[model samples]
Target: MAVGSFFGSFDWSAFLNALILGVSIASIWLIAALGLTIIYGTAGVINMAHGEFIMLGAYSSYMLQNYVGLPFFLCVPAAFVIVALVGLILERGLIRYLYKRPLDTLLATFGVSLVLMQGVRLIFGSDPKYLAVPPIFTSNFQLGFVNISAFRVIVLGITIALVVALWALFYRTRFGVQVRAVMQDKEMAASFGINSDRVYMLTFAIGAGLAGIAGSLFGVLNIVLPTMGTGYVVQAFLVVVVGGGTLAGSVIAGGATGELQSVFAYFTNDTFARFMLYVLIVVFLRIRPQGLFAPSAKRR
Candidate 1:
């Protein structure tokens, strides 16, 4: 009788709502982690400044939309281009020198992150900016019994498109083969006439561009500020770490972690839920430190 009452009293409607929202949450995390995964997986460099790259994207969109009078839709790609260019310059000027020095690279990127943050803060003056989306995106629509934001749906669609595009880029193209070869063995790739330096430069730029896209989308979802990237980056790092720094791993980990967090929050408060999720993650890492999809052993 006790067990029956406990089961019967469970809120099925809320559970369904949580599940729906969980997918949205997963999309956000996956998009945020995408660039980090690409950078770390390909270059073997942990970019501590990735959050700054995201911040730049949001600011890039803001400037193009507000000053240049560009449409919001156009601003997205423009942000990508602008940030990718910045990333390219950064790789050429600084990061290219620290390739195999993990500790030095980590510290150097951390310094770069601080510089970017302070520079943006000085220019933007800590004011929270906003990205104005279309009226349609600002509206709420029903998804079965749940009320869903049209913007969230759009974000989810965008995330899926990015994933598919990345998959095709990495799996179907000649450039993809070169990238994989370099990742597997830089010297072997060089022996095959592939320019490892060029590959690293391009991949880093693309990864940064992906971060820019995430920032552009995220700006509309939350207030745009220099510090905005910090929160998303934490989640991004969590996704990448748990995912084992692979594209597919990020997708899987993002979904699982988002769903688990949502379900936990449904039962408890958000604070407690996060606490529980962190505890679980610690336990999981303890059991499998290599993560869900560790890189191939071929890579030194």
Candidate 2:
């Protein structure tokens, strides 16, 4: 009788809501991981400063909106451009030099991350900043048994659009061929007249730009702080690792992790859910270290 009563009172609506929310969570993580996947997959650079790039994007949007009164939509693209330029400069000045030494690149990017965090704290005074979006996105709407945030729906839509755009960019463009060529065999690509340096620079810049867009959306989802990027970066890394350095892998890993976390949290608390997720990831990695989608033989 007790078990039957418990089952009878189960909230199917809440389950539906959690499922929808899982999609939103997956969208956020996928957006964050996409850039990392591209940079790592193509260049074999594990970017330790990716979180800082995300922070810079949020701050970029805040600065534009506060100082220049740019609309939210405009600020999104502006942040992308700003961060992409930063990425380009970094790739040219520092990252380009450290490519052959993976350890040096890792340490250098870690230093860059510290510098960016401190710089933001100095400039912004360690205060939390808020991004204002349009009123239409501020409200929630009910769809059947689940209530969903309009902003989350917008974010999901944007993520889907970006994914499609990235796919097209990677598959249907001449630049894509150049990037893939460089990824497959840099020496061979250079011999064939493909400038590997130029390709790496552009790829890093695009990766950073995608991080910027994620940051822009994230700013709308939560308060922006110098340390905000740290939280998201961990999840992004997990996605990239579990997906195994591929674009399609990132999408699948993000969705799977998000849904698992959501479902776990629905039954347990958030802290426990996270703990469980980490444990599961650890066990999975122990068995299949190559991840869900392995990179090509050349990438290995």
Candidate 3:
């Protein structure tokens, strides 16, 4: 009891530290989860390769910055465009064929992920690619007792802004309505003359674009690696399951879950923290098996 009490003291520094770490990791999960949710929820295709798209996006930033010597700010959008195009090509060439069959789609994407990782390794030689952030982002600022990296703060701002913009895109725009329509009932919505194909393409592009955005910022946070996407895939899957496959819920839940894991890991060891994360997923699924935020099902 004494030891437990000692560990549980109301120390402001520990509390703030936990909060910062939580917010940081949770935001990462949020980004990864957003891309996964968009593709999975809208198309009902579980894209196992979604993380590789993010990996590619990060690589895109590195190539543009280190290879072409583009300004850091410019590399960001280039990453987005490159990954978005990849998503488009994958959707048009592969995913479009596997639409009605869900499991096959998963398997296909899994294969694609393997190929992508290997391709990245073959090209980049499995060495972590270095991406240097601009001086402005590398600087740090203090908020009361908390000192935060400017880069992290910038990433958080971008994540929040993207979330808001996505919500608006889906909730306020005609394209969003069409996407939601297809999600709720693809066949029926298609019968209504909504171009399901276009909707799928656009949604897929958006998901990929979000991934590119995440990777652009994420590359600055870590050395870009071939299998880096492996880390994000499971976390995003869990976020989709926990949050119920909605774009908004995935972002919120992924961030929340990441934050929780980080804080728990801070108090515990890495293995135990991962165990706790899985336990939360099992506990969450037992409560809402259909997912927390899936659109109304139109399955006949």
Candidate 4:
């Protein structure tokens, strides 16, 4: 089909709806990628077990809501605390020792990923789990030509809140300064009495916590499974890479990719849309490998 003809036949209302859907999609990707961006951007650690952390978050929320009868809304933060603790333990026990050795860290985290996947499988079995939200969040709302889920709107609000909170945390806080100093020059940061080790530990924990929060939201969006993290992590990595491992980069990359994918999928099939998305990413990276927004020279 010719491009002009295709556009001529396109339903503008559907296109507008797709764009609105794109916002929700972007929020999802941004939430998932935010944690990874922090860890990799500041700490320079490519966390292979990130997906597992997300998985664990979903599981945490599930157990809390199912077994303890916790409210679904309250389970979100609970999941974060639980996963953050797990991340703390992993960083202190294993990740800390391997930071200087990037390749070893990668392999070790990959092993951790496997362990987490299997552990969840062993405990929860391979069956998919459902996360039930309140009735208010279960309905869809229509705005003009676009119809969207209430829960998705809530997720978008949460994502925006998180982005703002992170910005404040990274820029307006003393701890944030310490983290940025360590990222720019560890030796200099140390000379300035900044404990790089503690900074890294806190950063990793926060990252894991963010992933957990994302998992909780995702659980409601789709079925909760041990392997669900794998899918989100791929998109997270793409966002991080394309955004050049910056927080702003993640926001831009996630929004751009999510909208592009939705638009393409609207025009064609989902499978082909993904294929084209990947091809576009590849070509874009080839042309400007630095990403949409590159990190600072000192950080790099």
Candidate 5:
């Protein structure tokens, strides 16, 4: 009787909705973590200012949309260019000097984060800013048993495109070969005439540019603010760490974590779901500290 009663109360429709929604959640985390993965995996820099880079992306979009009268579509790429430039400048000016000094790089980037936050606060004040989107994005549509926002679908599309592009960049080009060589053994890559320094500069810029794209999308999901990146950064870090700082790892971790969280929330509540998710991550890490994919022996 008890088993029957439990079965009778099950809401298959809601569960299905949550399951589909998990994909959207996964995309959000994955997109945000993409840049962090590239930076940490390739450059070995614990970029504490990555969140600030994200914030800069959001503000860049906001500025271009409002002041320059660019549409949201144009703002996305523009944000990438602007933030990538900032990243290049940062690497050239400061981060390049701190290579192999993990603690110093972390502390320095943390200082950079503070500077960026305060600088933005001074320029834009504390009030939240909003990004405008098209009416289509504001609408909801049904997909099988689930109803989802159009914007989420768009985000998912963007995430897929990014992953595909990154895969090509990592596996299909001469630059990709150089990046992997550098990632595996900087000295070896340098021996072959691949400039390790140039690779690092370009990779860092690309990573920061990815964060910028994430920011533009995320700004539509929530109001833009100097501190908006804080919340997203936590989840982004989780994806990167759990995935072992590899591109493929981030993708798998993002999807698995997002789905697990969604299912947990479906069974319980949001807060408890998050608590349970964190507990699971802790346990998972305790057993496999290297994450989903361990680095090659050369990288180690």
Candidate 6:
């Protein structure tokens, strides 16, 4: 197990290749985790329907590309908007009613997710949809023996851009100030004449919207199934929890989570790696009881 003996002649080239793959996975996790971090940080609501929102995005993108015959570039933002709208509608309807009863909020959002996913199933059947990368994007280069796909590179680049844009919006805007206000102390924010209800609604919508965009991008980069969002939702929460309860915490958690999952998947069975990852999360939560970097003031 000594460092020098662990690899008599380690290959730096292979190490770089693995690093590239790790970056790809990490970028995706950042998007998925953004949804949870925003909603949980701003509104203190654990929206279970978050995944279904992603499902909505993926399907929206599918419809735009295939059914509407729109171009691929157009489908990207349209998918984001469509998902954001779904989140908005859900907030105005079901989410508002269950806010006071948090435990019920979970059930309500879970119901929304079930309903949304099942609705897709009924309308589209259980078939998976596909998105074709544009010709210029489809062509990729080989680095020595490794073949890197164009779509994977696109996913990583877009995810990085999204993270930067979100970070700016959250930390730089008045909207962000109001959101942080409510997050820090809802009752106090309301007392100071801030519109708590409206903020909550918008915050939730953004969270759902983020998930939707992530799902759509995921579909483009991978497979599009009705249950596709389910895998991501679980991953998102794990990232959020592992990182901590704050927005920044989620990012930190997501990167770590994605890296571990990637490394494990390479050397171990995917199923076992996934299980142990969750087990590790549970153990960490038990030890800290407030995520790795959760705000002490928000601790219940």
Best by TM-score: 4
Q: In model 2, where is the ten-residue run with the lowest total lDDT?
A: 291-300
Alpha-carbon shift of residue 91 in model 5 (angstroms)? 0.7
**Which digits, one per residue and each the tens of the lDDT, describe model 6 over residues 22-133?**
7777778878888888887776678888788888888898888888998877777888788888888888977788777878887888988899889999998898888776
The CA lDDT of each predicted structure is: 0.90, 0.91, 0.85, 0.92, 0.92, 0.79
**lDDT per residue as tens, model 4, 1-300:** 988998789898999999988999899989999999999988778898999999999999999999999999899999999999999999999999988887888789889999999999999999999999999999998888789999999999999999999999999999988988888888889999999999999999999999999999899999999898888878898999999988999999999999999999998888898899989999999998988888665644
4 versus 6: better lDDT goes to: 4
Per-residue lDDT for 1-300 in model 1, tens only? 588897887988879999988999899989999998988889988888889999999999999999998989999889899989988998999999999796787789889989999999998889899999989999999866898899999989999999999999999999999999998888989999999999999999999999999889998999889888888777888899899988999999999988998899987778898799888988999998988999784833
Report the Cα lDDT for residue 194, model 1: 100
Residue 29, candidate 1: alpha-carbon lDDT: 89
| lDDT for 208 (candidate 6) | 76
TM per prediction? 0.96, 0.96, 0.94, 0.97, 0.96, 0.91
Q: Candidate 4 — which residues are off by over 4 angstroms?
A: 2-5
Candidate 3 per-residue C-alpha lDDT over 211-268 given as tens digits, one digit per residue, 9 for 90 to 100: 8888878788987999888888888889888888887678768777878887778777
With candidate 5 superimposed using the best TM-score fit, by how many Å does residue 287's alpha carbon deviate from the native?
Answer: 1.3
Worst 10 residues of 4 by lDDT: 291-300
Model 3, residue 252: what's the lDDT?
Answer: 67
Q: Which residue runs of candidate 6 sit more than 4 Å off their true CA positions?
A: 1-12, 143-147, 296-300
- Residue pairs in steric clash, candidate 6? none
Better of 2 and 3 by lDDT: 2
Better of 1 and 2 by lDDT: 2
Clashing pairs in 4: none
lDDT of 5 by residue, 19-135 (tens): 998999889889999999999999889888888888999999999999999999999999999999999999999999999897898899999999999999999998999999989
Off by over 4 Å in 5: 1-6
